[model samples]
Target: MGLHGEELTFGVEEEFFLVDASGQLVPRGPELVFGTEERGGELQQELIRSQVETATDVCRTAEEVLGHLTRMRADLAASAAERGLRLLPSGTPLLPKSSHEITQKERYREMADRFGAIARSSATCGCHVHVEVADRETAVRVSNHTRAWLPVLLALTANSPFSGGAVTGYRSWRHVLWSRWPSAGPPPMFVSLEHYENSVAAMLRSGAMMDRAMLYWDVRLSDNQPTLEFRICDVAATPEEATLAAVLIRGLVNVALRDVADARTPVIVPDEVLRANLWRAARDGLNGSCLHPESGELVPVWAVLDELMAGLRDALRTTGDLEFAEGMLARLRSTGGGGDRQLAAYRTRNRVTDVVDELCV
Candidate 1:
């Protein structure tokens, strides 16, 4: 196996939209990124001025990830408050956004010039988990093991129930919107390292991606790091929820690393089954059913969670994250996933702004 079992350290990247006191989208945000960076944070500008991203340092434990996430979020919140702005931690635009200016980087400007409408409307935020791997080929291999679980993860963090003052019906309208990008969505099963590289080359030729660095796949080999980055989740509603996703993913990586060492075959489900499952998860969130990643039978999402935790039991205990992971799941159960929580708030006063107000904290 390429990756050492103990070397699968992880980190989290979260993107957020800038907003105002009344839960309206704030159009400009480079100052917010700078402000947070000045405060000793790792915040950076996203594609648009209305969005910012925070990337955490590589961490060895879920607890460490939680601390980093909490600190970075608080730093950004402080920065936003200083400018009388707020942050909205969801997938879709929470309100009718004002005009957005692209971030002033040449690459970003080029992206805007080429992608045009998609670039303009693609301020959708997400949570990305990066788990260290031995090499690019190993990252490609582990993805075959990890892609099956993406729908469940997406369901657990489906935070975009409404968009632009209208109920979107789907829990993750952001997922629906993001699907419009030519290069975005689940990664294809690759036969070998050559296969992966050639496929990426083909995407560039097709203009589906601007560069190797612009892979918008659910899981991809990091171009700049020795990691497998999972991008199948909405930006979680809270730090706790994000931590749950991160810990579970790290545990899964641990298991996959072992499986790779033993030469176990990676699970490969049909593409249609994978797409349908994602659709169901984005539609139903945790309130309904999704197809089992392997068996292809519809079952309660909680039952899949049980199966997942059972598979992850030993790995989590090894990391001393079993109890913390369970507690976070319990919190998800009590408060429901982000979509359920947002729907509950929207139901309370029949106002989408209330949902934004609640998330602002």
Candidate 2:
């Protein structure tokens, strides 16, 4: 929230893997992270040298996000071309990659030293959306309202279907691998801002996470920014899809704020149930069954997605994002998703490079 009561600003942080000509993840992130001074957005190294991430400047419309995301990706892709590597905006490595080096940072070094195997093998990527909030209390309330729809978001953007040159039997295997972290998953519904703070203190005391930066929940209040950060979705296949996801996230927050202003309490499920649907989203994407957010009964993923769209329709319309969002959704429905496309390509010729070739474009 800003001076305007209807202010809607957001940002997207997307992680990507570097790969060679053969589609294997490679330890070449530095070439992009250090050479991205001219990129449209800020580029940073991830925990592993095989992964790099880009953070967009604050954006108020889908066009800004598209401009920044397109330019940043093109710049990175060009840099990779110069080095004979490819910029792979994937949620997980399609082929098995050798052990990668961690970035030379004190925090990364400490993580590798303390977490051991989990840190050694963690190279998954994701797209995190941060929607502006007026304060921490509002962010908490918005997070509570947004919790039930997390899995639908994941199902929509899932793009990690192959791993180690074989079908992994899961759309976003990155979600499965990322869940190996002790603190990563759906967060508990907090009763108040105080409750949220106390819970973080408890987690710190238990040593579940090294710091506030490691909250890792699907949605949480940002420690350094006035926004509610969503860590639910995988990096989408294209810039248009990413823009769709970002605006949808903003719509959810806008609707959540309306509910909060009206003194409406959100209907929340038990933590276990939320985690159940999350796992279902990871395993099936949109091709299998998922639980209804309210009924808790298994249903087709499209039904859940329709329910989500209905909930956000008013907010999206009010924000002038309805047409752009609908266009992207139609395109995705027509062409299918990145994960499905990869599986379809693999079905032809049984070649993983064929899948990589499609992504490289």
Candidate 3:
């Protein structure tokens, strides 16, 4: 049976760091905050005890996403505050200490044991958006179509500019740090669902990754749900930013599915080119040029976004998210994105600690 457009529900998953009152990373705050029964399940500990993750329920509209995200952020912040810690939504800690403790879980323990220092040193956080699809076939197709655009999304949501108590000089240093993994970056094009499955199986057998969960492509088919998860964005610093990112991602999926229904061929940019484009976005964000996914020529970031929005216009209209998406995009363009805002704050105070303080609020 052909897939229907109305099945395009979406959800947002955001990872955040816990900081002390001085705006420094706290290695045990997540455990202290989320280990209690009263804290409930909406928040969970991450690989590192300094980090926590929260997910919103599946939402169909941008308004619902904004509402859920706002409520969850407030709840998580309150929980953290009660423990004398603050919730920080940036992609990386501005003043992280040399080491971070791992959460007390078997899976996290195994990851630390298997990966050694790499696992321990990874204190980065991110925002993931899952867009629902009808089946694995559609998920794979949507993932393929969405690959090129992931970097553009990353540029728009770049929030990590500092690491290890110093400026990293990259807009989304989280992406740079994440690229150290063997399975990160854009996924390769696949001819069919079987091809995608075989590729993941090969990665598993090769021992490069522990399991399917480690298949950390920029976008991928969700192993535990009927959705295509966009894992490229930094955890946005504000609720509105996160909501806008989710809305655009859902619209992108809708447009890709429509293309699939029409039997249009998917754009197949070379993996090398795709990786270069991702690097450019990570290093410079929207302040610089990006390689056009179709033409492979360097273009201003705004132009690329314009083309992308044009492609998704119908999907946005059908989903009733066009107005919200457009307004957010305009604001981002005018005021700059989260990373730019962080830098502006740092410049004003001449201190990374002050930047962290801004993020805490």
Q: Please, what is the TM-score per model?
A: 0.96, 0.96, 0.96
Q: What is the per-residue lDDT of model 1 for residues 253-300, given as tens digits with 9 covering 90 to 100?
A: 888878877899988977777888999999999867999987889999
User: To one decimal, what is the Cα RMSD in angstroms of model 1 from the true structure?
Assistant: 1.6
Give per-residue CA lDDT, model 2, range 1-361, as digits (tens). 3324666889999898888888888887976778766645688889999888889999888889989999888888888888898887778887865547998889999988878889888888899998999589878888888899888888888899977778999988889999999889988998889999999988888888899898889999898888899999888778888888899899988888888878788879899988888889888886667888889899988787777888888788877888998887777777777788778888899988888888873
Q: Which lDDT tens digits does candidate 3 get at residues 1-361?
A: 1156354788998898888888877887556555544322256678988888888887778888898888888887776777898888988888746338888889889989988887888889999998888589878887878888877898989999888777888899999988888888899998899999999999989887898999899888998988888999999999999998898888888878878878888889989989999988988886767898898899887888899999888778887888999999999889898888889999986888888888994
**lDDT (0-100) at residue 172 of candidate 1?**
90
lDDT value, residue 126 of candidate 3: 97
Global lDDT scores for all candidate models: 0.86, 0.85, 0.84
What lDDT does candidate 1 reach at residue 24?
76
Q: Return the clash pairs for model 2, or none.
A: none
> For candidate 1, which ten residues in a row score worst on lDDT?
1-10
Q: Candidate 2: list runs displaced more than 4 Å.
A: 1-4
Whole-model lDDT for model 3 versus the true structure? 0.84
Q: Candidate 1 at residue 175, lDDT?
A: 91
